[model samples]
Target chain A: MLAQGLTITISVLIASAFFGYLFAFIAGLCRLSKNVILRKFTGFYVEIFRGTSLIVQLFWLYYAVPMLFGIELGSNWWVGVIAIALNYGAYMSEIVRGSILAVAKGQTEAATALNMSRFQRMRLVIFPQAVRMMLPEFGNYLIQMLKATSLVSLIGMHDILYYGDILRSSNLSQAPTVYLLVLVFYFILALPLIFLTRKMEDISKKGVASQ
Target chain B: MIEPIVTFNDVHKSFGDVKVLKGIDLDIKPAEKVAIIGPSGSGKTTIIRMLMTLEQPTSGDIIVDGKNLWKMEKKGSMVDANEKHLRNVRGDIGMVFQHFNLFPHMTILENCMTAPIHVKNEDKSTAKQRSIEMLEKVGLGDKLDNYPSQLSGGQKQRVAMARALVMRPKVMLFDEVTSALDPELVGEVLEVIRDIAKEGEMAMILVTHEMDFALDVADKVLFLDEGVIAEQGTASEVIEHSTNERLQSFLHRFRS
Candidate 1:
């Protein structure tokens, strides 16, 4: 049962993290777009997701949204994934926007003098350097998003925390041991993310260094 | 008489209320090397910047190769140039900046290759060969794989020159290119520019403070003061025998 619970947890984490990053880059670039309507719409999306609680979002999507709209989502799991992705993506997009802005203005000027089109300038010169700046902060958000996946159990997804709860309710005497194992499970899951972050940080250092 | 390659007709520019350029007229013949000498805020840098399209003229016209630079024909009438139009007209011009704004992530070779391959749509193998040739000419032949951070200021400036040269612009503008270098390192960058001026058929406009270097290479020299050409003549005629009081004082300060 615990193994099955871990599978569900990993599945949700992977799916949400993928969509989260997709939303992040799109919303982030849109935030800097010259089009006013696009900039305002993405700004609104970011504010709405960031302004609310993730747990509230998950609950609303899973329960309240279905009743209010009188429609059935394909699966309860999707609701959890969408909530986590939207919430975490909004937070990460700020890091994206700030890092892109932080790249030296001279880089843009140099690209312009080379006769690169505006799209080519951003894609080849600006975004490559901006990605290096975004990596470390993005690593932090990835790990945080992993921990937030534990909240998905409340929406009837059988994550590790759900299994732990079941074990505790069945044997009250084993409650402390059960929760202790859950903590260990979370730490173990976070270990690889920590390692990846260190690797990304090393690469960013080489890209950013100057003599 | 050969047609002039570039002409500026009564151009004016102002940043808010401060006028940087006022009623400027200039002309350059093909392969002519012109040096502009002036004090700060004399609008010397602004002249080349307007040519490079880095800044726009507040009024009047810049003609490059007989085409208006800041205006395009739309519906048989001249309208303010758009990005596409500016880029098409600007393709004939190249500039070397004072700060050597090399892209930090790309190696020196990649810096030279990027614009040719991406902008001009040259194939990779040909671009690589041309980039290597240009890098060799600039004396960075072996440093092709090195990033900008690994290079000294002089070497970085040379790479900047190579990057501009690979495009083979009809007119090259050097905006105080060596002003950011250490005094000891200035000689190497200037030496490369001198060699380029000797070999390339491109018209060159150099805005510089080095009077000796100005006289060494420039065919004509202009002393700009108070947003106008105070004096213009051959290098020796203006640099050595000028009778303008303000230019004499300006050269006096430089001498000391």
Candidate 2:
């Protein structure tokens, strides 16, 4: 049962993070668009998600949204993933936008001097450099987003914390051990990500500094 | 007389309330080498930047090879050129910046080949060959695989020149290309520019502080002051023989 819960938790984390990055790039680019409508619409989205409480958003999507819209989100996990991704993606988009803007003015000027179109300049010159700049911040958000995934268990998603709750209630005497095991599981899950972030930071430093 | 390759007719540029360039007129002929010398705020760099399409002139016309650079004919009337129009007009011109803005993520060879392959649609092998040849010409043939961060300032500047030269531009603009280099490293970068100027294939405009270099490579020299061309003549005539009081005071600082 604990293994099943762990599997479900990992699946939701992966799904949310994937969709989160997709939404981030889209909204970030939209915010920088020349069209007023696109910029305004994306700005509204970022504000709506960023201003609200994460748990309230998850609850609204899982419970209130179905009643209001008369639409089924299909699974409890789907609602949890959607809410978390939307909220986190809003925050990450700012990271994306800031990183892209931080690229040196001289780089863009050089691209223009080479006769590159706007699209080519962004794709070939600007984005490649910006991605390296984004990695350390993205890694921070990844860890925070991982811890936030435990909130899904409150909505009956059967995540690790949910199973831990069940075990603690049945054997009150083992509650401390059960909670300790739960803490260990989370730390174990986070270890690889921490390692990966460090590796990325090192590579980025080498990319920027002298060999 | 040879036709002028580029003509600036009454060009004016302003940044907000401050006028940077005031009613400038200039011409660059094919295969001509011109150097512009000026103090920090005299708008020498802005002139080359406007010609490169990095900055737009507020008022006036820039004609490149008989085509308007900042204006395009729309339904038989002149209108501000769009990005496509500006890109098309500026395709024949290339510029090297003061900072030698080579792409950090790419190896030097990739930097040289990227514009040719993407913008010009050259085949990979052909682009690679041409890039290698250009790198060799700049004396960086062995460092093709090195990234910009790995190279010294002089080497990076050479790579930048190779990147600009690979496009086979008809006009090359160098905007104080040695300004950021270490004093010891400046000579190497200047040596490469001198070699290119010797070939005399494309017209070159150099905005520089090196008066001696200006005399060596440029056939014509313009001294800009107060957002206007204060004097213009052959390099020696302007540098050694000019008696304008303002110009003499400017040259005195460089002499010591």
Q: Which candidate has the top score in DockQ?
A: 2
Per-residue alpha-carbon lDDT of model 2 for B179-212, expressed as tens digits?
Answer: 9999999999999999999998899999999999
Residues A1-211 of candidate 1 have per-residue lDDT tens digits of 5666898889999999999999999999999999999999999999999999999988888888889999866687888889999998999899889888888776777788888888898888888888998888788788998899999889788999999999999999999999999988988999999998998898787655222
Off by over 4 Å in 1: A208-211
DockQ score of each predicted structure, in the order shown:
0.59, 0.71
List RMSD in Å for every model shown. 1.8, 1.5
Q: How far is B19's C-alpha from truth in model 2 (Å)?
A: 0.6
- Model 2 residue A177 lDDT? 93
Error of model 2, residue A44, in angstroms: 1.0
* Per-residue C-alpha lDDT of model 2 across residues A88-162, encoded as one tens digit per residue: 999999988987888888889999999999999999988988888878777877887788899999999899999
Provide TM-scores for the models: 0.96, 0.98
* Per-candidate local distance difference test: 0.91, 0.92
